[model samples]
Target chain A: MAFIQFLKPKNALEEGGRTAAPIQQDAGEPEKTCPNCHKPIPLSRLWSSYLVCPCGYHFRMNARQRITMIADKGSFLELFAGIVSDNPLQFPGYTEKLETVQNISGEAEAVVCGTAEIGGRKCCLFVMDPGFMMGSMGSAVGEKITALFEYAMQKRLPVVGFTVSGGARMQEGLLSLMQMAKTSAAVKRHSDAGLLYIAVFTDPATGGVTASFAMEADILLAEPGATIGFAGARVIEQTTKKALPKEFQKAEFVLQHGFVDTLAPRSTQKQLLTRLLNAH
Target chain B: MNQIPYAVVKLARDSQRPTGLDYIQNIFADFIELHGDRRYADDPAIVGGLARLQDRYVTVIAMEKGHTAKQRSCRNFGAPHPEGYRKALRLMKQAEKFGRPVICFVDTSGASCGIGAEERGQGQAIAENLMELSTLCVPVISILIGEGGSGGALALAVADRVWMLSNAVYSVISPEGCASILWKDSKKAEEAAACLKLTAGDALRLGIIERILPETELGEKPFYDRIRRALAEELEALEKDPDLVPKRYDRFRRIGQVKERT
Candidate 1:
């Protein structure tokens, strides 16, 4: 209790800079050279190639891109796109960060939930937007997703959600964590209704997201090269004091460990989904 | 949620596995178990029987909860392995073809997630069941007798009438798992449970389930009569109501829905 200045509006970012951003690092994503290469390719070309730099520096795809690549041609009709969070907890810098991310992504929250078709097969889709404050679940995301599930149930469609997150948004504090339970409950309802839920694990599908619906999919699919697990590998290694497997966190490792149902590459994603839907 | 003697029609919490099947026979006369998915090996964990519920004949598919550690290990603690789900789907399809009402008793913590369960296409099996259950023409009713967690519950839950006892808990994952992953501490499970909204009350409010049968105070005690009485009302009403049967199709589609006001 000694001088723990509860930043009335600022989330208590430790003075040591574990806090997300004060200077707001310029997404250092686009403007970097492929460290593996001596040549510095233009960022646009790298970004256009789904962020795999010419020399193969793998950049993460936000949920929006994932839906576009996987869904049936021109098939996405985004649901619950206008829901937004109000920074009720008033965590320090939460409002600014929320606005900044929202403006950049043109999305209300970390998840874009709606009904779409994957190769003519209908399914409910929830795409987690890492670019939106690292795709953390807050009240808004939960409410939107809950609505999505309700809609899916109403329409009698199967569910497909892609989860990519750094866990609950610390800025939203406890309210953020509450979303985990809310969304999970919604998932239970989906199950009780006997709807097929396909959870797609993308790059770094971690933390609360992994524990809930991501693992709850009737068929859990993961992208190649995606990182998926509960606690981050680094944290687990630190706590257990054990060196983990070389492929411990990658999607391949998850598939090997029996956590993931299958690994899907970006190119053949549409065909794979169609085949699955047909078989089902 | 204990083992059932489908042959004798009795309910007992402690007993042998095959013996429990005898207890079922006591309650249900002329009970004939229908087995095999017709696609793979027969699953003993999930058992279905054609039995007389009073004067009417009904199809009852209940998970055979294992009483012994060896049985539990094989059944994965009442969890229907992939073949179990497959078998349940086959029974429902046959029930539809024969024009018989179906009753599903859910009692497991999600579907099996072990290595063999995965190899046998656990997720695929669950998905197939969901697809078939949604389209089945027969009136289906579900009662949550125990854990009712995740896909295991989902495999048989699409029904015209869905009921849960007072003590059962349902969710995508357990509260302890959620707390540990979300908070990095397992001790916060209580908080996670409260937030999960997974109890019967929350599910009722969500319109995800239709009925909540009464349970004894200190509801941990088994009330087999309560289950029978509630299911009796549902089946009787379904028999009389012409629209009662379409619920299976509607129930499946009425799961997750999200929309934004433009």
Candidate 2:
């Protein structure tokens, strides 16, 4: 039956005799479908627009891609590249999973931390990579972020972070949860030193990360339509056994609820950050 | 005694287990229940107030999962809302202002995961606690009397000294949640519990907690008495240290420390 279906005519017509257009598959330059507008956007056009769709949908960007977009050309010096999570609890299959994720994501941990120049203003920056197990906060991620905040405090530099995570890494168990407290304390020290910290919540920032440094910023900014909450929506739905609002946990909803200071769209984020940095 | 990890989790979550109010009532004197987060309504899940710990007056906050079914329902099964965290933070800050040591009893399955909680900013509420508790001027001690469930528990557990009951289990996610996520079967929670290393012994070995109080008497007067003496002694020692904030920072700082694998 599958072979018969596979052998069906490639030009099958709809009710109006209109054939579906084949997805554009130019080698190394495919198209991405925007989740918001449901439009196929050329990858190059999306890249040129900093991965923002024409319809204002913000695509999830990798940590390096975000660094490139926000940091000044040739000014991003990555730090803590050697820091990676070991299977501290020796949780079953965690070692193999970490190795696989590292190979695929090309990053040692969920977070990429460093010093960078934003429009000629120097600041410590950390960007979480969603590709790396949804940017879970494990021991290594917590340690690196703590080290970054401490370093920022020493240098008396402002810290700007972009967070995207599924929360603390469950594979690492309690150790991963401890990272939330560890990073938050470091952030507190940096904050106590009278340095500014701005956090940019991107895509989905939920669970442990949201309950820690993601929400500990001096000035909190979130990308438009991002999901920012402590608990997952599905879990909430299951626990409450009720239908959720359409905009529940969205960036707009969070702003309406007065949690986020503002929503910065990707196109104007760099300028907004630069302005904020200068003002502080 | 070696117990099955899942069995320990069950023991930690046993409804017959003494709730937060039990400790506040048994361990301290002249308990005056303070109310409200000031910015919002009072959350029953978290009960906070001023009390006398031996000779010193202190502030106590606890996540209360009432023993009776009706009480549990009233307390939202100890799942705190954003206001609960805010209330805890307000009390802690008040303790700092009065130079009083702060003590917390954490026994939550996690923060409330509901629409109202999200709407009221649960994440922001917990985040503020973690940040403020890190540098609160007064000495703070948090004890996991029962379940130490993720961020909700950490919001209250970021203290100068964090201790746990021997049976209490703490983890990033519940064993059932972890099992479902990892193996796509919630029934495998037993295996997940084993892998998580969430037992108090594991936490002590991993250096996530300072000490584990044995549950030999299991909520008898002696158990409370032992905790009270520990608290009184620890607070006395902590009060003399001028480096409370820095030491607390270092305490959490060293947890989960990993060397760069060059």
Candidate 3:
């Protein structure tokens, strides 16, 4: 009897005929949301919507895509591509994860920074990628942002930092936090040069990123349905012990409550950018 | 989230304007605005206007965010970007040299963040302002009107009397970012907000602020009036009691003590 018990599988079903099964019965269908309205629309409609919702809510757009939408076909000249991230802390498994994410994302850091032309107007674009570990800012990210700032100053071009982030990168620890000081200093330098800087807040621009240069833009424009704020909704509710309004972190709510300059629909963002540049 | 001081300026305008123009319209009659850092261009974000408050002449510096789209662009949304901070420091030192008590209205989400601001040394600018503020020979008073986030708020915060309103928030970082870093989730920002303890009540309880001025029950009064009254009482009180400087200094020095083990 003891021998039989030792030979028995961990699960009664394992010993018998039962086999492992998937948790969800409907695994074939995954939810795809409309970028504009944030509604659970089918993938077919999402694709047809041009990445925007029928209601005109804009989905988060990365640097390259934003440039494509703004500039002539392939007008962007990527700069600072040589800069790559290093594992200074050498945290366990971090190097491997970094390499894996880098390879998968085809980028080292969250920001793809360089000088680009949108509608023939020269400007600097620093686009934050939310897909890359939720776009956490590390040393490379900070350096790239600083580089963009420097480039903007040297060229006397306006700066546009399209930001989306999950705050400071935990992997970098103090180094990530130091970026706040670093980026803040860089922004200051640019401001002293009397250059114009416009902050374009994409979906989910929260945390340390928002705390620094993102909030300091001469013109702070947010995408419709984009979340732009320093503190998250949950944090405020937890601290204040009160339920937040439905549109707590939504860009519309922030605009209504005086957090940003304007909420531009995705279709007109390029035009708005050009217009703001002209006004500046 | 902060109210401005249009009422006091209005009253002064009505009483002080020699020929015509209303107080709000002709603020210069009661208060003269000075500009420029002398080293560079004048920053419109920071308004350094010489004002007569309670019959006492004083230098008032307020971080002004624009009310309209054009204004927000002009004032950098009240962030006192690098140049703004520098302009403010210039104002502070000038006020000190003249022996005019410094009254600052802090309403920035934080310092301006731009490439130019970075090149101009945003941190150094803020640090210098903080250092200057800590050692001001004359009385310095600060009030948090809106979003006092991080060193931008701290730079102006070191003063004889620090006050905040009910709806204002002051913190190292906005509560949302704190949560995302700590909990690996931005959705749980509510947890971080509670943890920061950054509301006016918490600040007052911690002795970080001297007092909290309640909004009047006008139920119909303009926010500008509430702001003016709050700022006026503190300004007038400190003006009358010059000794409040040392007491304020001592009060500030006593904050953040830690016991050591032998």
Provide the clashing-pair count of each candidate structure.
Answer: 41, 0, 31
lDDT of 3 by residue, A73-121 (tens): 6778888876666655343455676666666555566788877776667
Q: How good is the docking of model 1, as DockQ?
A: 0.05
Clashing pairs in 2: none
Of all true interface contacts, what fraction is found in model 3? 0.00
Residue-level lDDT tens digits of model 2 in B55-133: 9999999999999999999999999999999999999989989999999999998999899999998988988999998
Candidate 2 displacement at residue A179 in angstroms: 0.9
lDDT of each: 0.62, 0.87, 0.61
The window of 10 residues in a row where model 2 chain B has the poorest summed lDDT is B253-262
lDDT of 3 by residue, B125-170 (tens): 5645644565566678787766666666666766788887565666
lDDT for each residue of candidate 1 in A166-272, tens digit (9 for 90 to 100)? 66554443344345445555666677787877877776666556645566678888877677754555544554476776766677866875667888765556787
Instruction: Give the chain A TM-score for each candidate.
Output: 0.80, 0.90, 0.82
**Order the candidates by TM-score, highest first — what do you get?**
2, 1, 3
Give the per-residue lDDT digits (tens) of candidate 1, residues B54-164: 677778888767777787767656767778988888788788888888888777655554435544556456545654565566778887655656546766776777777
**CA shift at A84, candidate 3, in angstroms?**
2.3
User: Between prediction 1 and prediction 2, which has the larger lDDT?
Assistant: 2
User: Once model 2 is optimally superposed onto the true structure by TM-score, how far is the C-alpha of residue A72 displaced, in angstroms?
Assistant: 0.9
B240: Cα error in model 3, Å: 36
What is candidate 2's lDDT per residue for A1-280, written digit by digit as tens?
0000001121111100012234367655676666566677776787788877788877677888899999999999999989888888878887887777777677788899999999999999999987788788888999999999999999999999999888888888888888888999999989989999999999788998998899999899999888889888888888899999999999999999999999999988999999999999
Q: Please give the range of 10 consecutive residues that has the lowest summed lDDT in model 2 chain A.
A: A1-10
Separate DockQ for every predicted complex: 0.05, 0.54, 0.03
